[model samples]
Target: MVRLIAFDLEGTLVKSVSGWVELHKKFGTWEKGKEYAEAFFSGEIDYATWARLDASLWKGHTKDEILEWVNSVEYMDGAQELIEFLKKNGFKIAILSSGLMCLAKRVSEELGVDYVYANELIFDKAGRITGEVNPVVDFQGKGAILRKLKDELKPELSVAVGDGYNDISMFKEADVAIAINPHEGVEGDHNVESLYEVKEIIEELTRGQ
Candidate 1:
């Protein structure tokens, strides 16, 4: 029996604009921007420089503008039904994301999930985005957070469902990891594309005594 059902936010549950894409669109894709940010996540660049570069990306945009962009995001089809069914089955649901907390919070509210954990976007006094989250959970750090949750909850069975490498971390601790492929170039163990199929998989996986 799966007692806990955890999910990834962006790319997994919804198709929101990615921070990298948004920043690149605004800042003209400075190779340094992508390279250094990648390096910082990979531990090549220190935290301070990463913060400075990230802040520069949204230097002019106000918080309201960012929220507007997020409001336009589209959800994975059948995402709502899947969450409701799981809840009816007595499973505790949580969203674990490597994306921005601002967007994750919106997804959580839309889906009515029990909890959400994601990197926060810092703001300046003028309410402009100051920088990306410090210690962001992009790759391996995602798995670390999952492991921590597993230890804390110790659910009878923990299942993770997601659509990207960031979701791969769920495998570190979850009893089962259902990978959904909603975008090209992303690979998963299950490779499901629809939320209805995901609901069926969960039902099948939990069937029988």
Candidate 2:
């Protein structure tokens, strides 16, 4: 009796493995971005500090320029179909990612998602990157966020689908955890190679409910 589905954005619904990394690569800041990512993963820096460091790389870029980059991101195969299938089956959909809000917001709007939570890069009055950030989702905080969402939404059961290490937290919070093309060692109640397979899994889960 699943009432909701939470999905990771990059590498789950979207083709990019990480929207932040892709943006950094596009802006020629990947070298520094990679270092910051390593530092964060190694426990040398907190998420806020890491996010600030990454945001600073795009300080002078205009919002429109960043939006252009965001627009370039493509959806994963069967993303649209999977979302539509979930919606049609009367399940609330949520996008929970540690990626940037620029891309997450677009995906939510385009797919008509019910909820979304992701980090945000602040902008100045002239719409330029401000070297600041609103770190709404921490790489290791998905479980806490999901628990909060569960309390607020009160879904009888919830499913989480993702592919990265960060998603492991969400998987723990969800009633049904699905690892979609997961990274090494990331396990879930079920493992799938594609979003199409996710549809079949959901269909089976919802058969009697």
- Candidate closest to the true structure, highest lDDT: 2
TM-score for all models, in order of appearance: 0.83, 0.96
Q: Count residue pairs with overlapping backbones in model 1.
A: 0
Please give the RMSD of candidate 1 to the true structure.
2.9
Candidate with best TM-score: 2
Which pairs of residues collide in candidate 1?
none
In candidate 1 the C-alpha lDDT for residue 92 amounts to: 80
- Pairs with backbone N, CA or C atoms under 3 Å apart (clashes), candidate 2: none
Error of 1 at 132 (Å): 5.9
lDDT of 1 by residue, 1-209 (tens): 43788888777688763655665555565565778678887988776566556666666677887787678788888989999999887688888876677788898888788878876777788888766455455455667777777777777777888877566667556777777773565555566877898899879877772
Error of 1 at 18 (Å): 2.0
Error of 2 at 86 (Å): 1.1
RMSD of each candidate relative to the true structure:
2.9, 1.2
Shift in Å, residue 107, candidate 1: 0.7
